[model samples]
Target: MPHCLMCTRYNRKCPGPIDAPLLFVDTSSYPSGKKPRAKKPSPPATSFDVARRFEDGRGIHGSGNLSEEMAMVWSVDISPRHVWGDAFFQNLVAFFCAEGRHVLGAVRRTPSWLHALPRMAATPPPSAARNSSVVRANEALGLALRATSAAFSSLETRSTSLLHHAYGLYGDSLRSQGRVLQERGDKGENLYMVMTSIMLSMFESVVATTGEGFASHNIACAKMIDKALEQASTGPAKGRGNNPGAGGPSPMIVNVFFHVRIQLCFVYLTTSDDRIRNDPIMDRVLLEACGWEKRRLPLNMQIITPFARLMKLQSHADYEQLAMPPTEFEHEKADFVKAKEEVDELCADICDSCPRSCYNIAYPPFSTFPKIKLNVFGFFSCQQYCTSARDGQFHHARYVSDLSRAKFVVAALL
Candidate 1:
């Protein structure tokens, strides 16, 4: 007799009689040397049935209600085979709910699409029942989240299987996103679509070995940000926006604009792609939308602006070098160096402004470290940049040296 599929795949010894019912195949009913007539197919096992099996210790014991149990089947820590299953997607959503704040850092506080994902995934919009566009977009977001989480897990475990699975999910997410955009046109500018774009960008940024894929994802994200900002500026029709309570653009949209701008700046800096560099008009629009001119910005933004400016200068220089004569390259190089110096000065100013208490909290005895350690992490990150710059080499070699020094600093501090 053939081995039971589950037992074969999971490498567990078949518990003969017990496995027969679960497999839904009755060998005794089939007579030897004769094919048995077809019987009515059994009804599919429901979540309640799965829950009972789990409760009886015949399957993995996953805590929670039936829906949760169904979702649990995909958790990497629980059942690795279901990496692309709906259950795994649910687990990914749960992971984001619990740890997304830490994983995403300061942006977590903002009311962005990511913040809305759990609710959207669990309850879904009532309109989704009637709207195919909304349904596809929502599924895309879920797939993107699951893919990104799987990619992160793959990084930690160095698991080839999980990595491949993540790519599969990412591909499906993109397909669904494309379908929604093709079908709905302007209606595709919803929060779920934006969230899908951002999540895919993050996944590409992490798992992409080459700059090409990462750069593509960044450009796509930039376009999405522009569309979203334009919609917010024009103002949606009465009762048309995602959140009725939001008088203006939601904090989430504003945060996403800033995040994408910062990310694009980094991409331009690394790739020297003029097309990917910040547009002055769009920057102005974002600044106006976020009310940056009228109010103090976060500490991180304050620090990031100078670096972004430096990169913008570098991007212009790159373009000028490509277009101008060799003799003119010297002038652009001089300009870049000057901008670099200003950035260095800004970094110094930010470091000097770092609170003494931040140093105290980051100091020693890992057990006593405060829960809010970003201050300390930020200080170290700034110091790392300074150390890397002092050597006058901004290439791969400098990165290595800076990382080594930063690790040592962290070790000593902890």
Candidate 2:
């Protein structure tokens, strides 16, 4: 009953039948009791990482007309002369427009974490005197952006040159970071400095080594965000709590936290914590600080919290099954199945709701462009979900978000 009641009408399988709950197939016993690594398939351009660009063709197979990628410029928002007055920072802006924006935000579509970076990067120049702290923060942020671009390109394309470049840029960013904290550890430039740490940490998580540290140790930026909120509280003199989220919730701050939530959620999912294992409903101080009191709160409860609960359970179960000998897996297998079912069911109900209930993604009532263009009133069966993206079925962000989360739910169910 929790699944779409009209799935058969749409020529699809029901998402899942409650009577037949999905369970994990333990393959740990194969290959010397060591779980063999599953090779990840490369993501295609249409759905994700939409562009594979080589900024510098040194020691790499050049692509078709990378000139378009390089041509992403914003001549409108801020004066070209100011550009926050940092070259590396300027490149960071271009990188986001060219590749980084499409990579995460366009694919996930869950309130883009990409919104805050360029805006923060594109602020007006600080005074002519140039506050040392602000200057150092800008330089570090720009270097980190350059480093991030190189790191991702190298890993995605297996380019040795980009990898080497990423390493050098990372070191430069790191050296600048020391100066940033030592000068003004608690003052302004908190957001930019924090964003710099996040980009660098991402490079560390994926590029620096294997990616172990990014999960466990990359939480400093989140804490730094909390510090940013603290700094924002004290106004000029009175220092009354001027809530950013109070009036309408500053979009910039809200965007910052939405992005922060992604990292925090990621860390929570990957790292082992006994407390979160018992309780997945975290305080999520960052979201609160970002003022997710209205629709955003509902969105998180419906979307984020449930999925995270499912993932944390899955992560722990994976550790237990993989770490222990395959022979001992059966002892805990039943318990894992029970817990996974509850979480999976919750995510399914929230994300994959009936399309008719939403903005009716067809021609007449909802011709708001990018229609689902459902073929004669197709319905999403609660039991059946297709991972492949249809030509016109995004129906804007909600449908896309729901469909993607459902895939993870189904994957977990299996």
Candidate 3:
């Protein structure tokens, strides 16, 4: 199968900071037994930009404006202000915001909307009682954010030293998180802790090719998440945690949690792991927590939900088929066929819609952008405006990877 060359998601090679030229390979042009002509070599794509080191102006693949690129990736077209600090901390902050270079353009990947990452990274926790959960929480979260930023830098720069630094910080974060868990014991049901684990998993995903790191982090946090959700849903406040004076984490926490939950469930739905293949508990929590099954869900979610449900059901049926009676096995097999047909028809109707809804408006040749959007998603021309073409094709490529992931899921089910 022909996979995209511009993205780095799920271990696809990141084409650094270069643009996928308007040139597309058409194998059909060659007639049967016709000799193909060798084409003239073109100029090298300046390693396209992903993240940049301020002051030094060093980039991994290359460097370019991130603000406008961020705007284009978003559905609402929102952008962040240009980061101005020259300090290391400030660079980390800037990189955190720009890590979309690594994430490409998946909006839910980092949850950086409205400066969430900058705020989360820049705000140093205040001094509290020694060994207090507050102090440990601050250290773990603060360091995790820093490590995540470093991981982005490592990818952009392809620097082993930077990756080592990121790993060291990652170690610190783990230790701090362990302290929190140890100090609190069973009472360590913390939203911050969960968030920390997510970031750590993200760091591992970026730096490590094997999925083991990501899986480990998530599995460790699973019981904590389950317990927290149970408390939140059943607590007197309903949808709030049980701590008094703490009312609960903000609605923002819950909302981001909901999206990430769905995204991760979607992530594992296609995983090779048998223990978590379309986890039924996670599927149930996702539906109950966010209502992604409703008709009003986003276009992507609407198309994906049915298959998610189907895949979960199929995985279950496949696992139990040996013990199941012939009648029950046959019934599920019929249901699978019907579900697959319904999903195929549903996608066929909106097949044109995802392509029709968006297009790329190329910037001038002499402008800041190095390239223009011609994001070819196999069959359609949806622009993945992660950053300017002149900068890097991170967003465009990441979006492609996301599509590939979707294909993986659908393909498995079909």
Candidate 3, 413: how far from true, in Å? 14
Clashing pairs in 3: 17-47, 17-48, 17-49, 18-48, 49-62, 49-391, 60-156, 370-390, 371-389, 371-390
TM-score, candidate number 1: 0.52
TM-score of decoy 2: 0.47
lDDT of 1 by residue, 1-414 (tens): 445776676676677864454543434446684557789999977654553343233665446566755765564233433443344344444443333244323233332345565566446677989998888888898888777877877776686766777787789999999999999987786777777787887788768976666667656666666666556545653123332224445767666766665555445545644454444433442233233432244554554444443334333433322333345445444444544564455445545876655444223444443343443454444444344345443343443434333323322222
How do the residues 313-394 of candidate 3 rate in per-residue lDDT, one tens digit apiece? 4355333322334454444544444444544445454554546444223322324222322121211211211111223212
Give the runs in model 1 whose Cα sits over 4 Å from its true position. Answer: 1-116, 236-247, 278-299, 302-306, 316-414
In order of TM-score, best first, we have 1, 3, 2
Q: How many pairs of residues collide in model 2?
A: 8
* CA deviation > 4 Å runs, candidate 2: 1-124, 156-158, 216-218, 230-244, 273-283, 286-302, 306-407, 410-414
**Number of the predicted model whose lDDT against the real structure is largest:** 1
Whole-model lDDT values for every prediction: 0.55, 0.47, 0.50
**Per-residue accuracy of model 2 over 248-280 as CA lDDT, tens digit each:** 324455556555665666555544666433432
Candidate 1, residue 277: CA error in Å?
3.8
TM-score, candidate number 3: 0.49
